[model samples]
Target: MTQQPHLFCFGLGYTALALARVLKQQGWRVTGTCRSTSNTEEARALGLEIVIFDPDHPVEGLAQRLAGVTHLLSSVPPGAAGDPVLQAHGATLAEAAPRLKWIGYLSTTGVYGDRQGGWVDEQSPLTPSGERGQRRLDAETAWLALPQPAHLFRLAGIYGPGRSVLDTIRAGKARRVLKPGQVFSRIHRDDIVQILLASFAHPNPGAAYNACDDDAADPAEVTAYACKLLNVAPPPEVPFAEAALSPMARSFYDDNKRVRNDRIKRELGVTLKYPDYRAGLTALLATESATSSSTTA
Candidate 1:
């Protein structure tokens, strides 16, 4: 029998859960942290060793629990109150660096602000336009500066399973909002997991990778495509300037950059499970429709 590495994950969110699932299947002893009691129970139910760690209510023995961990993965968002793992446990992790083989930090491609529909790669400069993007950029720097082999994964918009363009359309949010020549990159959650696993298999210290698909489609085209897939009329078109937007929504429009995933392919030797949104959304819709039909039958 092969000896699996012990994996410790911080911020067990959607993407983190996907990674955990894959790691567990590969025979790793997967453990994760949760801020709330309910989340702790949920993690336990998924066969993960759960630890409660909230900056607000600091728990004892956190360092001890993390002592023997070999691989560490963090999906915590970056902000004043967001990244508790980095703010509170950076030193603990640094101290345990000898045993730690690989550290993965989930970041956003937003770090490369609007390239005016141009392409950006891992070599691109970090110039985030929005506050959230800036925060992510800062966190990436903090993690890399630590005394460990850190791998930064700048993820594009993530969608999979319960989350996809078709889901948004079914939920009455398939609006065709155009920002002139605006384009955005995306990746399926499954593909993100595959890339992360590949990176783990071939560890690269201080390496940065963009986790996006091959296509950088226009946002309007994606929404319209989802409507067509669902056999529903596409939502009326709304120009960017004419649309009423929240601060967060408007910030998304600020970065029309296309992220390149060639580094992950070349370095990690990863082939994307869903190279484009078309295949991803179609698979998700088929599963959803099948589930609905079974429920009614």
Candidate 2:
């Protein structure tokens, strides 16, 4: 009899849980960790096998729990103290390296920081503009240093489903900040899942792939498009300098790079379902309409 595939996730957040659910439906055993008690309960409610894990509270008997895990994914971001998962369980992972078929580390395109509206592919040198990006770069280095072939996915701005410009408009919080020549790369959440699935099938260890759509568009343009889709008047354009954005939101504008995702297509033989924002947004709107109609029926 063939051995059953098992996947262990370090942080079962939005994207990780999305992947976990798909694999579970396909007969893969999925187990993972969540930091808080509420999240633990919620994941359990979703039929997930979850455990509490954080810097202060590490999972007991983690090595044993990971015994049959054929695949590993870490979606946890590195903080000032570095990667919480790596800090807590690096040794256990190294010891179990041989048995793990594939290991994936979720990184960010922020690692290529401040590209000045230039383009960057997977091979571009990592020069993060901010502390957050640097921390992720450090975590990527540590993960790649492991004996196992760790695949690194450098993702761009992730938006989909309940979290997109469409939702922003409905909440009456839409803003179109005017910053000319500044563009961002983004991927739908489902597309991100698809990339991960494709990588699982291809399994090229030690490779870094850029996970983004074909479009590198201005934020204002995206906002306008969303408004059009909803038939709402576009919000007044606020000059980027005059916009009262929180520090965290302001930080995102620091990077101006268009990421290239050719490697994923060339190597993984994967075609993105939504190749750009237009396609992604249209599909999202259609889905939302269908859901609302079905609920009312």
Candidate 3:
């Protein structure tokens, strides 16, 4: 029998958990890092060798834990302006490159900035508008410059089982915010895992891929669709100027670019399981409804 490659994920967030679970099922000896002891135990119970590491405190056993790890994936978001991982662990990764076969860094498509509702592909120039977006772009550059084979995956807004438009509607927080021609792209957690697995199987070094769905729908349309599905009234439409926005939400609204996913499909030979939000949100709502019914029955 063929042996599966050993894998280590630096952050076991929502999307990372899906990727780790899929790899574990494929016979890979998967290990991951978390911030707390509870998360470490939870990850171990799910069959991942867990390591507790917080870049803020800088643990001592990182190098030892990563020993003999063939594949390494990082989903850690960038810190304030100067990220410690890039300043400190950047050299550490370079030193471990000879033994590490593949590395992946999760980034955000916000790096492209607002395209005025225009389309952007892999070849488009990156001009991040916000501080967070700029930091992520910088981190991507740092990872790509490493001596080892590294790939950057710029992900769109991610939604999954417990996180979707239906949940927002049920929580009475779904809003139809109209930003003129503003449209946003998103990818499901399952599809993110699929793309990552495909990249691992094929092993492309020093490459960048956009992980997004096929559809780029307006935010208003998405909320309306969710309300229709749930047989509820959609929230009142709010004008972009009058909408109450948090710092993060305002920053997100700054970029209205539609990211293209052709490179991941053509190069990675990947097919998205939830190609669009409609299919993804529909399935999530169905599952939620079933669970609700079962609990009440």
Which is the leading candidate under lDDT? 2
| Stretches of model 2 off by over 4 angstroms after superposition | none
Least lDDT summed over 10 consecutive residues: which range in candidate 2?
A: 37-46
Candidate 3, residue 153: the lDDT equals 93
Candidate 3 clashing pairs, residues 3+ apart or interchain: none
Estimate, for each residue in 99-131, the C-alpha lDDT of model 3 and write its tens digit: 787899999998898899999987899998888
Candidate 1 per-residue C-alpha lDDT over 78-144 given as tens digits, one digit per residue, 9 for 90 to 100: 7665566778877787888757889989999999988998989988889998788888888888889
Ranking by TM-score: 2, 1, 3
Q: Which 10-residue window in model 1 sums to the lowest lDDT?
A: 53-62
Give per-residue CA lDDT, model 2, range 1-297, as digits (tens): 898999889899889888887887899888899998777765676677888898889888989998888999999999899999889999999888778989999999999989899999988989999999999999999999888858999999999889999999999999999999999999989988989999999998899999999999999999999999999999999999999999999999999999999999999988999999999999999999999999999
Quote each prediction's TM-score: 0.94, 0.98, 0.94
Query: Largest TM-score belongs to which candidate?
Result: 2
After aligning candidate 3 to the native by TM-score, how far in Å is the CA of 69 from where it should be? 0.6
What's model 1's TM-score?
0.94
Task: Give the candidates in order of lDDT, highest first.
Answer: 2, 1, 3
lDDT of residue 106 for candidate 2: 95
